[model samples]
Target: MDVRSSHPLGQHSGSEETGNEEPEQSVQRQSIIPSRMEDVICRLKDEVGYKKSFDVVVREMTLGDTRTAFFMMNGLAKDIALTEVLKRLSYLHGENMTSDALHSFMNLYVPAVQVEPEEDWNKMMTNVLAGSTAMFIEGENRALIIDAKSFPARGPEEPSLERVVRGSRDGFVETLMVNVSLVRRRLRDPRARYEVVRVGERTQTDVCIAYIDDIADMELVESIRDKIKAVHIDGLPLADKQLEEATVRLGWSPFPLVRYSERPDVVASHLLEGNVAVFVDTTPSVMILPTTFFDLVQHVEENRQTPFIGTYLRWVRFLGILVSMFLLPLWFLYVLQPQLLPPNLSFIGPSKEGKIPLVLQFLLAEFGVDLMRMAAVHTPSPLATAMSLVSAILVGDIAVKSGLFINEVILYMAVSAIGMFATPSYELGLANRIVRLVLIVSVAIFKVPGFIVGITAILLLLCFQRSFNRPYLWPFIPFDAKALLNIIFRMPVLESKTRPNLLRPQQRDKMPTGNGRS
Candidate 1:
């Protein structure tokens, strides 16, 4: 087999033979063709590029004058450890050595390592790229790949999104090893299982689905695995995107079927409830499968607060969603048909003196609000708040004074904006905004009845949507009393002892405590 080093040319200089030398002679006799290390280095340099330094060292050795060679690729090998191992192995020079002896030497000398012998060149290259050190001998058809991966890694840090007043601060990182460590560190139970799969044909991204083996339904886990396996995309930019595409029963549905979060505590809570969590390398977010509408609205922080406060917050969020979905459309309806509203609410109708079309007024206000939001988001942090204030005051004041839009329209848009903020997930919040537009148009055409019909259709669509055969509006639409309490009002941690039955979880119990007995 032709052998080459994955290093740069001229990085290391060794004696070159004028004609067929001992190493070359041995190569011909045993069919061990040696390509110049320079050729391999050139290929690596051409493929990976020259931005980063690539170094190689080649040293000639004679084990009982049998003629052998040692090659090391720098920056790829673990510092000091590989060098020390090489130093120890050098002592075997000028001693009669066989393939078995060399294998034995590597096995006994290497620390916490495994050697995979492969004759296929392609497989050897793949292993090398995956952080293994490949060793080829003069007469052997197979090459030994040693596991000496020591890439620089950063430890997990406190979560930014799912920050909790109580519970663990540790969160998953872009690294898969660190993420698995975080889960193992927290659960520490033997039942916790992680199944790793490679996706992204070109990128070959590592994705792992983790759940408690005994507690997680095997069928549910397999379903998740199959769905993920079915994904044939080039790369998954984030775990959420993959989950969105793979887990949703209806891709067109506005509601999110999978929940993506950065907090490990939130993931831990979901796993305990028999939800499957998927972690992808290079992304901080972990995707929770078979998520219901209630899951999107619920916050882990709410669980840390008092039950009463949590329930109140949930109601507030619900009201916010209602307002977000209807406010603008209702305003448009009030303008189009003042007689349909109750007497007390009739004041919302357009002023008799106003000449501009109500539709145009709403469109203008919506544009103004959106522009302000975009400005705030795109500006630098230090200037963002100031820009928001400037844009809000300028747009509201100018549009009202110029008679281009009404004050009431501005008020309704502001309310809708506030409602949009109430949504916990940014994706879900944006979806609400889109649905609100459709609802508003319906209400404008047919009044309150149209708005009601639009809402009913949305709810119906949601009920029809599923995540891995589990209802998207589970526990709420089905009216599961226990799940409803846990969904709408944050149930005490101890009382919430079972996973959602809608998912058909294998394990029914969450805690060991039975019937509230000690």
Candidate 2:
């Protein structure tokens, strides 16, 4: 179905009487065209109600004494800079002044003036909202767009999640210009490229893609550009929403294809590796495309810390991920199939029998754990500690004493919850929770064999998943030995010379070692 015709009103057909009244309608339509144009502007203004949050200003300008009207949003505009431009515009003395002449005057004569020639009125209006001043001519179809953007911005600050001890602490900010500067500051190479794209129908938010010109693959850049262009939304509420929708090959998959980080070092690393980093306006998080499962697990801090310590931490994280997904399910399977377990392991079950069914007992324990976690996350910091104590000590202890849940099940659930928190990305942690339930159901139905099969299926699905033609399980399934070593065990910063092979970056080497350095 055509998107335009999908609306309920558009789907409804006109009556035969309405069709018969076409002759009269044509006469009325001919008379109403100009009025309809006025009505269009009126309705647009009505729809965008004059809220105090938005400062709407209607200013009248005279070029060569010819009166023209301009509308702009205050506070969003650089009033001081705009005043300078207006001072120059108001002093026009020539009667033969055309739009082009006025544009030239503004460009050449006015300080810090940017002129966009022969622009569409609607697009120009969007620019106006984005802090550009628009100039309209009486007879011309085009308008002049001037850069007067003056929204307040702060410099990049230290990243909270991706803190690095040795590397740069600076991270991307909400402002696009500031973010671009941050990247440029780190990478002074002339080959570094930044392309800004406007997204969102109503928001018209600025999204920037940064990469090294020689290092980044041309096709990869084009693919990212196309995906970003195709997004048609009112506003990009979060960078993740756009990145998730654009990067995912299989939208239904729980695995994340694109890696998100707040650290500029990580983004710079990805850019150096040939992956495109998308920086959305009003969001600090930068998204790296064509990422693998390992990318999300790796951190910039790994490169900063001692190689041995980093490797140990990586292994610990991997183990945590495993426990988070299987601990509870393993307990469930143990309860269901006590005979399959080794002779010594069978004695682990509670001594006292619980009145609730084993599955129900596990479910109730899981529910209470999840509830406590949710409450802790949403609650204030002071209340969070109190709630945690109440839930962990009072609720959990009472449930165990009442014989509603087994102590072993509760213990496993708590351990699994802690393991889930070890994951750096919140989205991946949520996916882990979902996969845990699937593992539990599989074990309940088909015992240990079912659990293994379900895990195999998940791995197969992950192996099949792609992000912009790059494998989702990079450095693992495709088996790049060097990349795998780097991913599995942290490589010394100086020893690592090449970017991840999965991205297929144009440039292979990031740095060259001097002789005798080792």
lDDT of 1 at 430: 77
- What Cα-based lDDT does every candidate model obtain? 0.69, 0.72
Q: Relative to the unseen true structure, what is the C-alpha lDDT of residue 255 in candidate 2, on a scale of 0 to 100?
A: 75
Worst 10 residues of 1 by lDDT: 4-13
Off by over 4 Å in 2: 1-54, 62-70, 87-100, 136-142, 152-160, 163-170, 233-235, 246-249, 343-347, 512-518
Question: In lDDT terms, how accurate is model 1?
Answer: 0.69
| Candidate 2, 243-357: lDDT as tens digits | 4675454568787777788877677767777888888888888888777788777666667778999998889888998899988888778777778689878786667667887
Estimate TM-scores for all models.
0.80, 0.82
| Candidate 1 lDDT, 437-518, residue by residue in tens | 7777777677778888998998888888877787777787777988787767777767777667876767686666674311
- Stretches of model 1 off by over 4 angstroms after superposition: 1-98, 112-124, 146-168, 237-243, 246-250, 350-356, 513-518
Q: Compute the lDDT for candidate 2.
A: 0.72
